[model samples]
Structures are given as structure tokens and as C-alpha cells.
Target: MRQYRHFDNVLLVVFFSHPRYDVNLDYYERTYAEYFPNMVFVGPASREDAGFNHSYDVIVDSYGSAENLTNPEFYQMAGRMAHHMLFTVMKDHPCYHGYLWAPFDTLLNVPRLQQFDQNRFWYHSPFGEYVPNSALESDQDPDLHAPPARISPDPALNLTEDWKGWGPDWCDPHVGLPACLPAFRKAPSSQHRRLASFFENGTERFLGGSSDTLYVPGIHREAFLETLALFLETECFMEIALPTTVHLVVPPSERILFVDHWWIWQPPFNATFVRMKWEEGFEVDTFHTFHWGDAAEGESWRAHPENIEDVRELLQESARRQGVRLPVATSQVTGRSPTASSLLPVDQRQA
Candidate 1:
């Protein structure tokens, strides 16, 4: 095993909505502080409003309505805006090297924070192939609104012509993907600049960019890909089209890594634990992270505190085993002092 270096990078958790059962930001602050005392969490202040601000290290803000509406282009732009913001914060700030942008509803069981190379842009899912789960009838069922599929270099479609109006002659194919687009923008406002440049550079390279190279998150933030938002817009014919479907025609040569469980209806590649299975001392190292799925049935992480504890424990244990000194627990950790009895169980105490 490789000896892990002390990570100087900051972790950023981005959430668009505050789930009903979601743990207070303070809880996350305190918990992560134990392992990554330097980590930060960024999210919207409330689910109903569109506002942006930073709390401790967590960011609270709303996705502007214009960007988050049902329109496909708006959604693609919104994702672009979020990634641009992340790049700006990480690149501009002197305190951190890289950040993690996780949806608020996710249940994390990340036992150890791996040292991801900043040279490449890494994402939980690469090609966006959403394999169907047991709940779904089949993987190719177009009617099923399954989780976003992982990006596959080789789709079942042709690669010569632009699939949905995007390719190498237009611009970098990777720029179309939401997770990979931020890496391509020159600045946080690069989207606007790129739009302007598009006028000057012409639609050839501007719209037909290639996304062949593998993007290692911290290492290559600028590599582009057709984002989920982009796909939805083009395939579903949403209100706005972002012109990111070039990847569907010309997939990357490198294999993209995806979060094991992107679609709930499909069985995960190696899922050791499912939703609400943390209390059984279930090991967290089995998977990097687990998606809680849509917010319809109140099954998200916001509704489960025990799962949060499970996530915290897994990360802490990973840190301990790695010989990293955990941060001291303080009200600053949770934004409140610990109660006597709640602190009785050392393991149960706030991170």
C-alpha cells in the first residue's frame, strides 16, 4: 500500500436543496473536522430560495431560478455555473487544492479520502451509462427515467457524424459534460467568455469539441464531456439545447470510472450495503459512495441520521488507520457544544 500524504485539499459538498431529514451543516462540519479539519461544505441556505453564501466551509445558496427551471438548456447552464463556481473557489482560494461536489441527498460511506491526482478531472461516473436495477424492466427501456448513465467510450451508436449537434470540429467534446465543463472554462465567468469566443471562433470548434482524454479531477479540471443536463436537453428536446452530444458520436478513448450505483433499479457492481444498512456494523470500504436516489419517498440521506453516523465513522476509521490525527471535537465542529450524555459513547460522539 502507498503511504498517503497529508491532504491539504478542501472538500466542498454542493447541495441544491436541503432535505427534510438532512443533518444540520454543523453536524457535517464537526464530523469532517475530525478527519479533515480543513474541509469545507458548501450548499444552498434553504431549499425554497435562491441565495448563495459560505458557512464555515460549507456553501449555502440557491441555483438561480433561470438556471434551474425545467428548460434543458437552463439546467445545463446551471450545472456549468456550479462547476465554474467550484473552480473559481478552489483555484482562487489559498487554503485548498481540490474540492468534492456531492449532492445533498447522498449517503457517504467514504472510509478514506483518496489522493486524487489533480492533473486529471475525475468523476464518480464517466460515460453516464445508467445501468437499470432490479426495479427496472431493462437497461434500454426508454420510458424508464433511471439515474444518469455512466459515460461509455463506445456507445451502441455511430461515431462519425455529430449525434445531437456537437463534435471535434466544433470544440472539445469533454466540455459538454457538466462535471467536465468547468475544467474547460478559463475563469468562473468563462462560460460567458466562451459564448463570446464562440462568436469569434465560429461554431466549428466551439460546438464540435472532442472529449476523448480521461479527466483526472484535480489534475485536469478543464477536460470536457457531454453533461447529463446537456444530454437531457438534446435527447428529450428540452427547452434549451447546450450542443454537448458530440461525445455520443465520438466517445473518449480512455475508460471512464463511474459511481458503482448511479441507477437505483440496477444492481450495483459491488454493493456491500444498501440504503439504511449501516447499523449492522456494515463496512463502508466496499464502495466509494452511495446515491440515496430521488427525493419522492423521503428515503434520501436527509431522512437518515444513522447513515450519516455510518459515513462519519467510516471516514474516521480510514483516517485513523492511515495514521492521520483526527481534529478535536468542539462546538465549532457542530456549531454547538456537546451534551454530557450524548458524549458518553466516545464512538457515538460528534466528530
Candidate 2:
């Protein structure tokens, strides 16, 4: 992915972790820090406070949100913190134009994403294939990236998980909490009202896209993140909370660029797929997520972790996707690097 273009100058590829789960943050930082110095690790303070031989540029608080949302752990409440999280990074390094919210296990199609306009908001969806004959079209064509007037995906299937949410009008914030109490005072700004108007006459629906590989431009991200946090205040599913906010909070919806790819739905393959192709060995068309699984046998297809910069080890949620030791990603013995490149991540080099 780095070969086609150097994302170090264009975007910040983030690998984030929640405190509840376990992943070897130090191993990853040490392993890829030399070549992919552009990347950064984000873990909860608890993980750092627990005293691991690690340091993170961006650290987020683990809200115990899965329990709070009464939803699955996969949601990660990433949508809730997107706003404040970026602020933490952008405050010091103003050079970055965008952020890609990806988990440690994710493998993005850097070249595929780079072909499009980085200035626009980016997301890929299975809800509806907006790009016709997407495989044949040149993703770089200026005409191909325009946003539709309104994208109404299959009505029977809503993008937002209506089944697993509390409300924009919930009676209590503690609905799923240990104590019963009122929460998130229905403080609807006119924009919130517009958001409410979206649901009042009809149910609020989601634009619907994978939580992974989401790209919010710096210009629009703050608003997008703020709205996403608002939705989290209601305990909306992160998947739904994300795209819904993308549709509502991001103005000039025309700027919302959805990249439709086969890799997104089940992606190029399931999380269990193996055989991490060599960095130069991969095809340019696919982002090719690393083959992930946790048995001692599962590690073999991991793009030859010993030789490549692949850090596809399964973390808590990803580890559970197949089978695992429970909380942490399957452990591997990766020696840390002694040299920190001049390319070291902004937060690392500057801070």
C-alpha cells in the first residue's frame, strides 16, 4: 500500500485499541515503526497505565461502552470518539488532511483509496452499489466520484440497527446501565432538530457503510465526529451511528464519497482468510486484508509476519471472530526495532 504513494504526507493511518481487550501494542510499534513510520498506535490509558513497555501517540478512554450500549463489542464506540480523537492528533500536527479509522488487524487498499479525491469524505457500502460496473470504471475519473442527491438503499434493510438502539429521545441514559437515570438531555440543536425531523415523520435511517476504512476529511470531520458522539449518547449501534452521522452532520452531502468495493461486504475474503501476500506481491486493485485466525496453525497465512511488515494479528474482537485465547490477539514473538526512523509518526517525533 505504501509503494503506490506515500500516505505519510497525505493521511494518517491509525491502528486503535480499546483497553478491555489485549493486543501487544509494543510489538506492533516496534515491528513496523521503521518503515511505516507514518502509522501510529492508539490505546486506552488503562492499557498504558497497566504498565506495558509501550507508549501511544493517541490514547482513548475505554468507556465500557459495549456494556453501556448493550450491544456487541465489535461496535467499539469508535463513532463516539471520532471527533475528540482527531482533535487530539490534529492539534499538534496540522499537516494531515484526513484520518482513516482502522483497527490494528485491518489491511486497507492504499492505492485504491489514493486514486480518489482525498479531500472528499470517504466510505464504502454494500447497502447499494452506487458505482455501476465499479470494477470496470476508473476510480480516478472525476465524474465517477460525485455524490448522489439522495442514496436510499434497500428499504427493508435499514443501515442503522433499529433493533439494538435506545433513542434520540430515550427516557434515560442509564437504560442499559447499572443505575437507572436520565441521560443525554434531549439537547437538540436546530441541526439536531433536522436530525430529529429525519426520524419524526419517518424513522431515522443510516447511509450504511462498513465501520472500517472510513475516511473523514479534516474540514468536515469535526462536525461529523460531534454528531457521531451525539448519536452514541443515545447508544446507537456504531455502524449505524457512523453512517447516519455521515449523512446528517456532514454538510453538502454531495461531498460524501462512497467507494463501493467487493472487499467491503465480506471483503476480499472473510476475516479467516490466510496467505498474506508479500507487500510487492499484492495486486493493486485489492486492499487485501490479512488472513486472520488464532490457532497455532492460524498464524501461518499471516503474510509471513516474520518477513513482512504485516501486523494482522487478531485483537480481542477480531480474535473472537474465529477462536482465540479470549481477550488479546494471538501472541507472536516479534522483536522490537532499535531505530526510530526520521519518518517516525508525527506524534512520536514531535511530542
In model 2, which regions exceed 4 Å deviation?
Answer: 1-6, 11-13, 17-37, 46-51, 55-60, 65-95, 125-204, 260-351
Candidate 2 has an lDDT of 0.40
Worst 10 residues of 2 by lDDT: 175-184
TM-score of 2: 0.53
Candidate No. with top TM-score? 2
lDDT by residue (1-351, candidate 2, tens digit) is 222223444445454444422233444444333324455445455552223444434355444322244554332343344333433444444445666555554554432344556566666532222322233335444344322223333233422453234333211222222111111223235454444444436443334334555677777756665565555555434444455555565553354555632233343343233223222222222232433322245231223334223333322222233232322223332333222322355455421
lDDT digits (tens) for residues 163-203 of candidate 1 = 34443312224223333333223222334343333233322
Q: State which candidate has the highest lDDT.
A: 2
Query: Model 1: which ten-residue window has the lowest total lDDT?
Result: 206-215
